[model samples]
Target: MQQPHDTPTLGKRAALSIAALGVVFGDIGTSPLYAIRECFHGEYGIAVTESNVLGVLSLVFWALLLVVTIKYLVFIMRADNDGEGGVLALTALAKPKQVRMGTPSWVLVAFGLFAACLLYGDGMITPAISVLSAVEGLGHIEPVFAPYVIHVTLGILVGLFLLQRHGTAKVGTLFGPIILVWFCVLAALGLPQIIGNPKVLSALLPWHGIEFLVENRAHGFVVLGAVFLVVTGAEAIYADMGHFGSSPIRLTWFAVAFPALTLNYFGQGAHLMANPQDAFHPFYAIVPHWALIPLVILATMATIIASQAVITGAFSLTSQAINLGYLPRLRVTHTSSTHIGQIYVAPVNWLLMICTVGLVLGFRSSSKLAAAYGVAVTATMLITSILFFVVARKRWNWSLPAAGALTVLFLMVDSSFFVSNMTKIFHGAWFPLLIGGVFFIVMITWEEGREILGAKIQGLTESLSAFMDQVLADKPQRVEGQAFFLTGSYDRVPMAMVQNMRHNKIVHSEVYFLHIRIEEIPRVPNMEKIELERFGSGIYRIIAHFGFMEEPKIATILELCKGLGIEADLETASFFLGREKLILGDKPGMGRLRAHLFLFLSHNAMDAAGFFDIPSEQVIEVGAQLEL
Candidate 1:
């Protein structure tokens, strides 16, 4: 995913493809549990006659073909930014190196950011619906189990969130095998019904879907809001492309996931056509009585794996946002030492848990939650299409006509789903909009506040060259030990250095100004990470380059410096970090309300020593008040 490391042998690709089943396909794989039932028995129910059944199945088939298969796997996945895919990664790809007025880049970037925020909405809804739908199967086992569904769901969700700190490495090994079994069961359960009625196979033709929309007119159009659920996790496939590489994901999809999903959906339609009375739960109705309990248990495990993938994705997304300066610093714990992508964001995990539990209590059924599912996904899909258009033009250098043509095709599909989803705004679709709006505001505020603060500091500070020239000319008294001043800008004197000169009145025998710069790419190779410059008189400047996915550690930086010929003993060194307090200056560009919010965020932000993993006893905090 992070650009090709090597040409993987066939055996390696096969293993990665299998492992990807757990993480990459889990969300889409679980769609069969509720997608079919929601279409026929949901708020926009259509009749389950043979024609209607095949028609609906046809729509699902084509949507999978057009959106997930053609659009994402073929086109959008190719827009990966250095082999990283996702709205945020795509945004970085589409963002122009230079800003120009009247260009559409700004709009594209803004839309992409909002789309990224909407994924949080997806994060909250997916687990609620997936786990809730699976747990509801208990009712099939016994009528008495229906009453305890909510309690059981809440308990499962709580337990899941609580277990995040322990990491996923322990259970991750079982994810691929369990999801494989779940998909197999999905195929097996639906196959008999499908085999019994070959007439349902006619749904593979495109005309059935068109006739479905024409026969029902506007009613069928609205039903698309439900049908959109089939491709709800398509974005996740693109997002996780960086995890297993696109080759493995593409191979697994067509070879394993696609066939099973296609068969199960056809099988469900066949079952529905024969026994329309069981339309409320055709998925469970297709299963043999003897396999019901085991299937439900397997289904529960599969859904949990689905939920776990989304939860961990939220953690990884949060980490990206933090490193990219879209969000404030939060505690990020790397769960797997071997797997760079396996991470834990506790704050994000707990917040998602609270929302997931609340959603289950509010909707109380997967059918109602289905009303809220597609709006965020469709909007995100639309945004991804727009961004992909930009990347095709700017990065790929494709012809304008060619890029526009493909985008138009994608837009037509995305627009239809988004407008259809708009009809459900009153019926619980408002949840994602409200949540995404708040997150968008926070992201915009954080970015704007950082820029304003940087400008303010720039106006009050001296250039590094000027400060170094003056210090060498003055020849101030020097101390024995080394001093490393953590700085934000490479070519400006750190606030801590300025304050140290004003208050402490002496320079150390060895002075190193360190700045950590996060690059847009997922990772910066270690060999190119450290940039050093000598300013004479034992004073130096060290600029450390980190990728958005990499965490900066001061200890590691020092160790790397030692290898780069800057010999300094750790025991005799002290790290100086600037601590800023925000105050509204006369030229405060931010509105009063946003300024206050930024103040609160800055006040509670993780300190430099903690975030950088510096030794506590060796860190010295230098404080200054900054007007924003």
Candidate 2:
């Protein structure tokens, strides 16, 4: 069941464009802080020569052009699931069905879920690293403030996390103008150096990238560890595409953000080449001393916006995961209806706050945190590219040769970055890997637990209509109104429904066997609404279709059903929901302790009346058997 409210239109295209510029561009916008500097001057405590600088800059530029502008913005974003984008949205469009009996879609979903979990690790690290790096600029001004850098960084991060509940639309409004000014300032400071050393422009040529790789060989490959920082937020672009349509994101990048970023990076490279001896930060060297404070403030704002984007992304991803059944349903609060993307999750927000602050404290400098930031982002990107290829050929009906050629080129570039970042695993990159591993375990456990429970229910379930006939024949009990039975499967109704009719001496004029299926797509078409099949003797089997992006509201659908000529009165309908209380008598695979704990947790879960949007007055709960 879904509610149809007025889809509040975002202002005009221009305002929507500005909003997109603010919210969607944060990840890519903050890259100028360290992308070029780290590539030229290795974060691994080594000096990078002039030759490697051109090559690294070339790699960053080309990676953005090929991967971000071409692959995602131009192509992948078009593969939206009813105007939504992301792994889950894509999965919905694909409609991945189980290949075998034991095999559930959860197995396939785990891959994307793992990627989502890894993004959480990235969300935690991005803020810590981005803010710390910007604040570390204070060190260049005076060494005395260095001691309190971590303290200030942590405080700002904590404040940002707390503000998430307030919704980003208020704070987010300033992001576009702030980032616009920051990029302009970035290019303004660096333009003079680019004009002086025009040869640095030669880095734009593809051969320069090749030459750097040929000459530096080992070091050139490792440059990816740092180059990855440039595109760390590339996935955010695709993930946030649903917020502001695909066209806006494409136009925003090619028209505004792209050229500004390129010039700024070139400016940074030009500054480094001209004044190799200057101890001044090349990023700040372009700016005058009088504007240093203002520049730092702008940088801080941009970084905060970047952190906020990832935080919002985590919330959206968690919401999607819950709908897809990879994770248990957690409490979700919609921050804004006008902007479906604006959401806040209590557990996710708090956990991110703790992890982010811990990272800031542990790795006080952005340089140290940078090593861990790119790995999770790059790994997710590579995985996305792989999935994109499958989608392009199989789903999009693209020719194999064309898809293969496009996929191979992107994979080489992305895989190189992934391997490059892999070298930094021991040097703090292991943090994201550790987080991803832990999250993967949680996803798998929850998924496995559901499978076992589903199987247990399947074995115990009895045919509702047949059992009803037998109960009526034996007991002849009669009651008023319609009875709705909830079951885990659509194939057969639960035994509880039959037992309740027989033992409790209750019967209704009509019995509706309801099966609610949540689809992977963000929205369901009107044609695929609710299907009703009458099973004789006033027994009707109703199957309701709900999209992953939709919140299931059974009452609302029943109201909608009135228009289709099937009258369902919620006030008179008695809702019968089965509750499986597990008895832990030594389950074979999941040991007694784990089963007992799982059973305890499952038993205490929110009742179906609230979860499924049924009125409390019309609800009837039946406790059933569960062997674990």
Candidate 3:
């Protein structure tokens, strides 16, 4: 079977490109619905002036230009973790070669994972806020729809969430053309207003944003909270770069999406400036009465596609986390084998559905939900900016001066947005923070729990050389041929091997001490596959590294070892796996209840035989003790 990272054929590439236009562009594409309009006309107590509109638009335009275009498209995309992007990918890139237990590198990886857990909060809120806001446009056309809007939005959201299990292939075929037409229609709707009042184009000037910031200094800081919405999906550009190469996304943005979005936003600003009172539903009002219903339907479709992108993103992130050992293994179902990225996790899907529905029900309107949206995105963006700086200095080998300057610039922009969003904490933005807080706690607890368990195992472990000496001294029965033992930790020898040595008193002529290190990178290059160190007398210490994006199957590694002159026949090579049985004690930090729960969960985890894809006949499980 072909590996997951194999380059796509021409036909697959074409299909994926179309899907990219629809699914990938959804979140950013739907920004025109509220991002531009709300900047001047938000529910918050901010004044709407011509300069403010221009300034807000200027901010939006430059944010896209600086953060999305310059930072990610130009600089950060190159920081991809072996064709993958996002916090986990960055963690893999930044992970230290020689990890001391509690070093700064390990802490940074934990920080990255925390950022990822926080994204789940953003993921839930984005769909809720984006879709509801779009559907609320129906209330503008007919007042009767306003009463049932929340229910209708909830039903539609649930339906969309339900559709995830079926995969996006069939429905996704309509995304590219629909979004393409949506952008055209969006621009076309605003063209007359923009052309009529050409001054609206002045929003493109940076001075207007500066003036607005100077004049409305207090409220302008608050506007950053609303303005941050414009770039909510900016990180998706980098995260989804592997699906469609940086070339297509860059081309799509400049060639089609950017210009159209700018025109629509400018047109909206023009409509507001020309007739402020008439700007109540300027987007729909711009369309002819006969076309209003069709426009609403199109907008709905666009929002659904955007939600689909976020939902799929959650699945991909969760999978990456599991593979990298940050998360426990969950049931992962391949939604489409033809597309390795198309996957479904039932637990995650259901959890998101519950949270999203709860949000919609509680907030009741997208405007209310909007307050909770930007903070998480901004926080994640801030984390990305920090990681990118590291990538610039270490990976790209940029000078300290150049890297420091770039880092400062990004930090100013990202921190400004983060601080601005902080103003919304009391106004419903606290929801995502609460979600993120809970997730962060869970992640940290699990990580800390694992470390404590690993340390306990290390203390109980016996060295391979000492075990071998003990076995030879006993002088029992002697066996023949070479035996290779698989161990979880590099410090300890497998207990099964110790038992075998003690009983048989015969050391295999060639005993291999193998250690596998799965890196955080999505794809490990063939050149970095395996490293060998001779420990003397046919005893070789081998380290094999796999990336987070790649499956860690021994069979595949064995195939990979063909180049290293090592023949791995599973039937002949004994695979040893350690099973940790937790002994519950009075753990000081974690309460007795949590400790018991952790022990119960750990004990019932899936066996390594199936998880590691090793043959049952060739596998040996030795019980080890862990005190919690």
Best by lDDT: 1
Q: Give me the runs in candidate 2 sitting further than 4 Å from their true place.
A: 1-11, 45-48, 93-95, 99-108, 277-280, 471-475, 566-573, 590-606, 615-618
Listed per model in order, the count of residue pairs whose N, CA or C atoms clash below 3 Å is 0, 0, 1
Candidate 1 lDDT tens digits, 1-628: 2353144688878778778899989999999989989889998888888888988999999999999999999989888766778888998888976533235766776798799889999999999999989888899988899999889888988999999988989789889989888878777877888899989999999999999989998989998888888898999999998878888889888988888999999999999988999888888888888878898889888989999999988898889999988888887988888878789887788889889999999999998999988898899999999889988998999999999999999999999999999999999999998888888888878888988888778887899889988897888889988999988888999898899998988999989999999887878888888999988889999999988878888767877888789886666689998888778876667788888888877877778888888778888998889888
Residue pairs that clash (backbone atoms under 3 angstroms), model 2: none
TM-score of each: 0.97, 0.92, 0.89
**Residue by residue across 1-628, what tens digits does model 2's lDDT show?**
2221112344445565666777788878888787666665546522545776677678778988887888788877877766778766765554365522235644445556667778889989988988987887776566788788888888899999998887877656677777777667767876777898888898898887888878878877887788778777878887887777776677678777888888888888777777764323567666677887777778888899888888988898887777766666677787766667788988889999999988888877777777777788777877677677767876889999998898898888788888989988888888988888777766565666777878877776666656657755775556768888876677687666766855776666788788888776776765676878776666778778887777777876787677667788888788898877767664444655555556655765457787677899998888877676
Whichever of 1 and 3 has more TM-score, that candidate is 1
lDDT of 3 by residue, 217-322 (tens): 9888888888888788888888888777766677677777778888887787787787777545556666778887888889988889888889999999888877
Cα deviation of 50 in candidate 3 (Å)? 2.3
Instruction: Tell me how far the alpha carbon of residue 408 in candidate 2 is from the true structure, in angstroms, after superposition.
Output: 1.3
Ranking by TM-score: 1, 2, 3
- Badly placed stretches (over 4 Å) of model 3 are 1-17, 278-280, 470-486, 496-515, 526-543, 558-576, 588-597, 600-605, 614-620
lDDT of 1: 0.87
For model 3 the TM-score comes to 0.89
lDDT (Cα, 0-100) at 474 in candidate 1: 89
